[model samples]
Target: TSSPTLTFNDGNTIPQLGYGVWQVEDDVAEKVVRQAFEAGFRHIDTAKIYGNEAGVGRAIASSGLSAEDIFITTKLWNADQGYESTLEAFEASMDRLGLETLDLYLIHWQQPKQEKYVDTWKALIELKKRGRVKSIGVSNFTKEGLQHIIDETGVVPAINQVELHPFFNQSELREFNASKGILTQAWSPLGQGGELLESATIAEIAAKHDATPAQVVIAWHLAIGNVVIPKSVTESRIRENFAALDVTLDATDVEAINGLDRGAEGRIGPDPAVSD
Candidate 1:
């Protein structure tokens, strides 16, 4: 079976499962991203802060897929969060990606302390209006942060990319996204390596499906309806993570995994409200 997709409020659809390039070095990002295409990933997530958009652009150029066939998403860095600066930064990112239009563009972080995200959000709206981006969203935004933009612009973000996993599910934020018609895109979907995979419960579930722990974790994310993006440079793991599309879990299994939520203690990434 192929990967499934979720619809955005804007009438665009995104592949539910995607590959991320958070820490993947630029020197090797093209190779790794090309490997993801071979592994059946159509959606790719990157950021200006990741310092790998050029490599990502290179991989896309050689993917043998048309622009419409792939979903390319990149983020706006915190340093360029003002209205005019955000527009300028968008141009730079577009130049690096070599794309006339981006599938999705996100504010990498709220950077609420800068007191500029509200203006930055306005820039994203302008980009969407001019058709530079098919969809625009935010990453690491709190419930209040998301509402602030919606209230200011009357244009809801298509998705909220956040750190979510079996451990830190961001239930409250996810619920709010659901209610507000915003998709929840998961980053660090595997809990950033073998740490969350070490859980005996996850291991047991993996055994039940005859799959790897990473696959089980990803399946759990899809089962709960979050658009998941797990980053890995290993070719085997890239292929393995995509295989979550075929894995299915039962209510009993979902309940067991949901039991792993440790609330605030399970968080593995920086708090969105405090993070850059």
Candidate 2:
């Protein structure tokens, strides 16, 4: 039941396995989150755009777990990508989450077209100094986008969350993050659904370990030093997702899974660095 952990640039450690709430309904998000907590997940990832922060807050408050025992992460949306507006948006997110401070806060998108992400990064840096957020990072940022923020602020983000899975390993961006000491957090780490889970290659590996295909893939992510947050509303699935930490994939198995990467990405989500 021991989950892996990684130390961030800010000297804080985050559990490698996290429960992500991307499209879960607010009403269901709380119950599902509670299930995840009870299942031994210490990290929870949410976003302002998810519209479930209040529900997530309720679950965290009622979990009977001390706040210090959890690593909670939330993100700011695109429209809030500026200094003052980002500050206000951060406040709104904190209020919704019912937390005085966050373990980590991230920019949900790069939105370079808006040309305000640098200003947003500056605001996040100030937020860190103000002690409102422990660490700051970005999501959907390309290497160039991350470098832009670093060049302007002179502060490297603690993480960069992006779309990652066995199908799209993101080698170059991952190398870039590793070189900069930024953690690469994977959203949709399982792909859109159970498609990859049903693959014969994954199934064979799962059989060898007496584990599920999903768990096999998650172990692959962990072996590669990537952070993974797999979302699910089903209580059983939540429990199963947490069990991924227990399944260790061998190098040969990892290589077999790594072979699945297309080099070209099968990204189900938009590239927010360029999207509207």
Candidate 3:
């Protein structure tokens, strides 16, 4: 199967299965990003806190592909969560990425305790109006948090990036986003390489399809209409991650995967309200 696509509320399209460079080191990010591009991945997700924006920029600049051919996303860190500070942070990130405009820029997290995310969202709207950012969204935001931003700003985010995998499915939150026009994007879609591989259901499905467990899990995500960013510094795993598009899941496969939803009670990352 070919790679799938998800059209955002803004009408722009992003590849459903993309490459993520969350913890990749500066020394390796550029090269790995290039490799992911060569592997046929058109979307690349990174963050300012990941400490590899400069490297990601180098890879994009040298990829021999036009900037418009790639869908690049980066985030503004929590420390930079005020109106002016958010503007400054966005400019700095663009400078590091060597891009005049970004495909997507998201608030890295909703640090509610500080109560500055609303201001930050306002700044993002300004950035969008200034033509410095093409699309804006949030990461690590709950349903309540998402509603708070929209209720305050009257702007529906184009996407919501969260930690989701077979073992910790976020069905209710995704339903809420769908109702509000925000596309659900999965960050740790494979449980950071742990639970996904250990899933009995995944292994059985892999056997039935003659595919790897990772591929089955990723295909399952695609079948359910999610944009997944699976990260890997290894060449083989990168190739394997891309191959997930070829494994088509049947109704049984879909049901088996859907049964994994953990309801309103799963978390892979710290709750932002108390984390800071």
TM-score for each candidate, following the candidate numbering:
0.98, 0.98, 0.96
Taking all chains together, the TM-score of candidate 1 against the true structure is: 0.98
Indicate the residue-level lDDT of 163 in model 1. 88
- Candidate number with the higher lDDT (2 or 3): 2
Show model 2 residue runs off by greater than 4 Å.
Answer: none
RMSD, one per candidate, in order: 0.9, 0.9, 1.4
Tens-place lDDT digits, model 1, residues 90-153: 9999999989999999999888788899999999999999999999999999999999999998
Model 3 over residues 1-276: C-alpha lDDT tens digits?
A: 346788988888888989999889987999999999888888999999999999999999999989778889999999999999999999999999999889999999988788888999999999999989888999888888899989998999999998888877888888999999999998888888876688898889999999998899889889888899999999888989998888999999989988877754656777655666
Ranking of predictions according to lDDT: 1, 2, 3
Runs off by more than 4 Å, candidate 1: none
What would you estimate as the lDDT of candidate 3? 0.89
Enumerate residue pairs that collide in model 1: none
* RMSD of candidate 2 to true structure, Å: 0.9
> Mind sharing the TM-score for model 2?
0.98
Candidate 2 — which pairs collide?
Answer: none
User: Where does model 3 exceed 4 Å of error?
Assistant: 263-266
lDDT of 3 at 262: 70
